[model samples]
Target: MAPVALIACFPCRHSKRRCDKSLPTCQLCIRKGVDCCYPKRRAQKYIVLPESNGVTKDTVPTGNDSSINRAGGSNRSSEWDQQSPLEVSYATPSVIQSFGTATAIQFIAPSIFREAFLEIPRINIAIPSEVAAHTGEFDQIRDISATFFSQVVIWTPVIFRKNFFNIALNPLSPRRTEGILLSLCMKLYCTPAAQDHRDGRTALYKATKQFYCEVEAAGIMSVCILQSAILIAIYEIGHAIYPAAYLTVGACARYGIALGLDKLLVDLTGENNAGRPWMEVEEMRRVWWGILILDRFLNLTNPLRGLTTKDPEYDDYLPVDDWTFLNATAKPQDNLKISAAFNLKMGVFTRLAQATYLVNQALKFVSSLPPPSDSDTVDIGKDTAQLRRTIWALISVTKTEFDAHDLATCCQTAISYCAILLLQDCHWRRVRISSTEDAYKHMFAESECVLQNLALLAICLRKDAEEGKSLGEEFPVFLMQIVYQGALTTIEMGQGSPNEEIQERVAQYKWLLQHLQSRWRVAGIYLSILQSKEAIMASIA
Candidate 1:
């Protein structure tokens, strides 16, 4: 067969979406339930006419082809055409040769290198140069970079501080686009730009998002691009930017897949990893884990939505301490270590990974349970019961260790409690709980556990609040979802019995939600849900 031809359906053309150009229908069109049609006029769009003059009557397809003028004889088409090749693999034969006989891949044939590493294809894009357009802007860039690292680093420690600064400080440095985009992100987030647009997105947000889209559209797959996109997704989530936030995570999922960051990581193994530095591999692992964390946290409450990032495998390595990882010298992996297990000595990120794992396991366990119906009893299954016990035990211990721990830990503990409550609540509904006083008491205890954990989150947040700090600023935005669930659960338990303790807990949940709204707009969404529930409860009371 001849090389496949690329064409965009009219719908994709109008909507400004990527056209996979699949026969019958493109994926985006299929998603939107729209007709996919390729107009014959576009055939003339790509037809190349030989040029003896200053301009050629030819056009090349790109993300934004309207900007391309055929009369200008723009040679950009050849550079950006879909078939253009990108040199994505870092370890080439020449680079490996420098490591001498010590490098495992040095002696291996080039064919083996081709087989081991997949090169991501390239599409050329015009990187937005707002931050880098001037020589004098480096000082502002450095100043803005300070705001993101301190607390946001705890949420996802994917971007190394020194690497970011080196690229950021030296605007003319290699990988200039990465530096530019990162600087743009820092500037926007430092003193968040006012939402001047009617759509509620700031000018800075639009610029950063535009830069992100252009890079993604042009098939630029790098950790820098992924980190920028992930940061944008976090911003969307915190401010309750829907559909965009949801779609951004999905986009990052695709980007991570393209980078081969999530699965069958060849660079991480001791056998074939070859001459790549250990920190490089660690960065790879951290990026993958970061995706997993974001995906889980985004859908922690609504398991039905499923996960965008890959599920953590049995042999996956958890990150070492953030402090050590950031500051320490390179250590050769030469071995795959650190399975997903708990240790008190581990960093906050590791605890987050472990806690997130519990949530994922709970979701999987719940899937095994039969759907709810008019049944007196439901089988918990042997394996699932074992899993539930493990989750409960972990939550209990975290609860015991919860003294003066940071908000992230409290977020972890709170979510873990939410996870078990989710598992148990599905099979053991309120009607079933009232089946016996003991049953009711058991259910009540579980709610109280989750409620107290949520309350502790509020209390922990208050310290920062007392110091005139932003509530939920350092924590993941999906903590808003977990807090909402806590408030909802407290109300339900209170309705079951008008207990003073439950009511006091209800007040604490409200206060937490109220304070959290200062930092995360998603809190306002959940707070409204709580109000509606309270109104219904009052009428029924």
Candidate 2:
């Protein structure tokens, strides 16, 4: 009989080397001064008795099939398969208990969709032979990368500007993650709708995927890797490819969680190493918030789908002002100087994040309430009144903080208006058409306020783009959806009176949508509605 194979020491097994099976410490582990551990013998394989007839035979649980052990096989669906929101408990069990059983649902990038993410095959397209000039290609990528940092990075401010340039500036140094980020950025800049740049988009996408797989397989985790994923997610969102974005951001969130980014390390006692810059801590916080923003926005865009990050725990403050971020060189301490201007600018997104969380909570609460019959009108009114109070309170808080004439203010106001719209959206449409005096009166006032908010948003967008101060129609994809919502509201309101200013505003939206329609499908829908409404108005005149 063949001699039984010796089980290797843990160190040797981990290093994939031979072990002599010596006592105390193996020779190799002793030489390396590493601890030597031995694994327990595997349990004898046994058959699992079927609980019912016609069930397939199951094997004893093993390390490779731990998931199967939990589910009793690969076939059973968990809570995720039902498309339910993930209820993330607080990191501290004590805190969670004290916070009450509010049951917040964070849209985590569910593992149920892991198969779909893995299905994005590794692409390996080569660069064109004609463009094989190494120096030329390098310069071109750097230029596109600059465009990405300046234009695209604004939408997802998780990436640290200085660090990105370090890799981008030195093209000769082999950096796979940076290369993938550059390629994705190039693709976003040269989307298919750009007509002249369409060919480059596909090439960039293939190259990005190729490099991403290679880097991912190497098991690398760093800020650059996380930033690359965020950029790719943003690029996917710009093209309205949500599932792909969801997958990318989901992976990004996993990486962030693995890095413990949700909590500020600086806040933890003695965790900061001597040389670790305050910026590193800030970077983690920014990346965490960026992930949260995308997670909430993704769910907001498609309420039907399960969320990407569940009840995310964030104890960090909102990002500091741009002036402080861009200018400060010294290590920052507690009480970092904040810029009112920058706060005014970012307040919309900050409040939007909070509103989204509230919305999720509200959704959970609403779902739990017993369904009411038509005769049970009192219960429905109570629920509606409670929701309205919550929404108005949120609006009051947001409005009080930043009340400027900028896009941020306009966006927040629109969101507050949307809260009211959300409650009565279905009936509001009916109210607009109803002959009842009370219904018409209510619809007219709400519709007018909504249109004014949208008009301000449109003007802000138009003015910013026209003056070349904006991202050239590459505005936040979600914001574009809001603008489109405003357009629909404009159409509904304009059915009664098509005044010159309203007509002019509609024309401006039409002009803006023409530029955005390629990247955002909602813009295309808005353009169609605006054009159709114009045609109808013309026919009536």
Candidate 3:
């Protein structure tokens, strides 16, 4: 069985700060001068139930199935209304212990290398032949590739499909290795949790991860390898794989820098840009952007941590628009129509990137604010006003119900509103600490407006859900962060509310995540957070 770890404290839970949940007091609470209150709680045995029909097999609860446990076999779904998020299956500590902890190097490389490093004269390496690099059955791989492109690609798009199918599918060709690595990643991402980790890591995850380590050992490096790392990181994150998720993404940032991915778009405007293959460059650019996006999104739970990559500069070029993804004549930054204010025209991936940028900005802005006691005399209204306007500019311009069928766009929309929720939270907290009535009223009015937009968008999405599938059956699995943030936002700040409107939103966002658990167990982790929040609110009342 996956070993359980301690949960976050109350302040950490509310603010997304990292917590070790130590007894007496936590380090974060000590540093911040905040109350370190662990819930006065006890454990109870949870029964696992089978998922209903029409549910994706992967959604069945796995112990850290990837990012979080799934809804499958949980008699707990209905219990959520009466339960706390504390019950989310947690196995990340053991994952870190197994992977690269100080006490043991339990995964990939041999522990002997670590123990006898100075004693060994030299480390010998083996090179595998082309046949040894072989992945899986051709037809099965083909189907997996198609499924990935059809579903997950709309958000991540790590590889370009048109070029991939044309050049890289051959097991006989040199490009076949990259295709195989990418295929391996998609298979890991797509495989259901039904047969996944019950007491230990699943067979498929172990095999794919081993193959990835082998490729690295064989000196394989490319955009596809990075994409594979990203898939693993995403999987780890969804399953709350913790330090592994953190470390995997940090490696991506470093590897991206090592590969000079930061220069991909910058090189586009140079005189030497003429001969470069636009498709290959696009793929490279997307991979780099993927690293950047993941780097920021991963830090959402710990906003004060230094980002692996620097925040995006105002003119940092965005990706080639997703719709014109195959356009041969398209030049990088040609699609950018910059103005003081502008419409969201780039594409869904770009939209996701933009929203992530807002999240980063919110983190920075909030981090810069002084504690309420100190900031009481500071005139920071201008700074707050400018930041609020910047958030709304994106939210106001986006097509609220644009292409309801495009799950990527839906994810993008949800994230943009999440930024508002994040910002309003900062403001709301400030007002409460200062006991400023004017500030509270202002925040309430503005937050209400922004939340109404989010609610409407959720309604449009709910309409599209199939009759029997989960509410979020069609959403991309990577959207768990945004959905979780939205769910947390719907609860009214300060006094507890019986507001029907607030309850509707709270239920709606929860429904989106509850159903999405079918494909990605990450949803279950977020639901646990909601449960924890409910417990806190209940205690206060």
Candidate 4:
């Protein structure tokens, strides 16, 4: 065999070991757990060139020659010997074309970018100094009052509603119990005073007129009835005091010849009245009667001057001298004189009377409930017991001295108690429902009603506070804190649900927070002003 030059070999073949000749797989493949192979290369066959008509004899290179020149001017090996390092250059046609096109175009002056960078100064513009100052003041005032009114209205309802709802749902709420007691107190004292006070009666009359007008505009006939009733009570009080102030008394008297008490009594009790079915109704009637009695007592001639110092117990039933023009007149047990005296004193008696009536009515209703035959009876029984206690507490307040300041306090206290009672009623309604779904529905409804009443109470309390009357010293602050805290807590807890109901509740809470902040701010401002005044006075002194 002819000796052949070794080209590329596998690792095993290079070591003089056996080659597997497995095409791609070799001996090394077995050891490395892989496949390896060599490719077949085709060999070129050499052909002797024939001398042709145009061929030259010296064209081909001879073997073992250093330099053999050919007709083509170079040998194949010489060409290989003349080879140098490879040179490479790159050109991007797209980029080059883009640059060429850009260069061909005319450059525009004041390009968008250039204009943006070289704008003229705005020095020509000037704002008036006064306008600027006014702008700042307007902004400050806007900021201060921006959320004030909105927060006031929104938060007032939210807090009141939440507190009312929670208390109403809570069968054992202390607040509810307290409310009942407070209502009783106001009925006994505040009702009578409010009935007699000319200012208070006038305010009520004006408020009622406004309420009626609004209700009529809205076409809410049900609400109109309530307003009318309130008006009737107001008119009755007015006529009992100053007959001159009772121009409408004649109109009211068309239903009845005297003060319309008989008509009111008939309206309150029908043939089927069968005693007070609802304690609230009875209490309301009692309040009405109480104010009337108190008003008549005040109208007695010289009652304030000690001319008619009859037995205090029989004051409600007695007729004193008719000193309408400050002239002494001997009147013999005149019913008109008795009625007039009660009217004069009605200012100090109205509120207390109303509160008393409401409490007694509530208590009477509770007492009228059938005895509980089962576990459900326990709840009803407890509510009735609590309600009675509340009524008694309210009634106890009536026995105290009736003064303006005391009367206002009593009203505030009574309103608070009424709020609690409403809450209790809501809670009981929830419990009475048979199913969870029904319970939730009833709960929400009752909650809304309780909330509205609570809001009204808050408004009343606010009005009382504004009048520079005592909210029982620490009581107002305590009540406010309790109500605010309770409302916030309920909102936080109730906001877990992602439903529409919960969303609305959260919105209400946000409104309440903003309202509270505004109120606190106002209160703070008031305190600051007061302090500043005191400091100035001290400095002057």
Candidate 1 overall lDDT versus native: 0.57
Error of 4 at 157 (Å): 32
TM-score per prediction, in order, is 0.69, 0.57, 0.67, 0.21
lDDT of 3 at 53: 37
Model 4: per-residue Cα lDDT at residue 493: 27
Best by TM-score: 1
Evaluate model 4: give its lDDT. 0.31
Q: What's the candidate order when arranged by decreasing TM-score? A: 1, 3, 2, 4
- Cα lDDT tens digits, model 3, 1-541, are 3333366665565457788777778877888775555544423111122223323221111121110111121233221212211121222322222222211221233333222210111011222232233334566667877777766344445566665654245432334445566677777766655424632245666666777787665443456677789888777766666687889899988877655577764555322223346666676777777888778777666666778887775666677777677444455545452231146456667766676667778778766777787447644444556666766666555655454345334655666556666667666555553222333464644456656655665666667675443444335544676667766766544234435666788788787677666656777778888878867765664
lDDT of 1 by residue, 409-523 (tens): 3555656766766765654452444322433454634445565666776666666678887555566554667777777766665554547866776777677777766666677
Tens digits of per-residue lDDT, candidate 2, 1-541, equal 3233357655565457988887766889789866565554533222232222334432221111101001112232222121111111112332222111111111133232121111111111233322233213445656666665555224434555665555445432233234434445444444544445432245555556556665555343456667667766766665555467788888888887655565542343112222345665566566676777677556543344666565533333555444455444423443221212223444344555455545554444443444444543333334566565655556656565543234432344444455445444434443333322433344534445556656766666667668777444445565565565566555544564566765776776677677666665546655776678657745654
Ranking of all candidate structures by their lDDT, best first: 1, 3, 2, 4
Error of 1 at 166 (Å): 2.8
| lDDT, each prediction | 0.57, 0.48, 0.56, 0.31
Pitting candidate 2 against candidate 4, the one with the higher TM-score is: 2
lDDT of 4 at 505: 41
Tens digit per residue, CA lDDT, model 4, 322-402: 131112222222222222342333322233333333443443354355544455444543455555454444434453553
Which ranges in model 4 have alpha carbons more than 4 Å from their true place? Answer: 1-349, 363-440, 443-447, 456-541
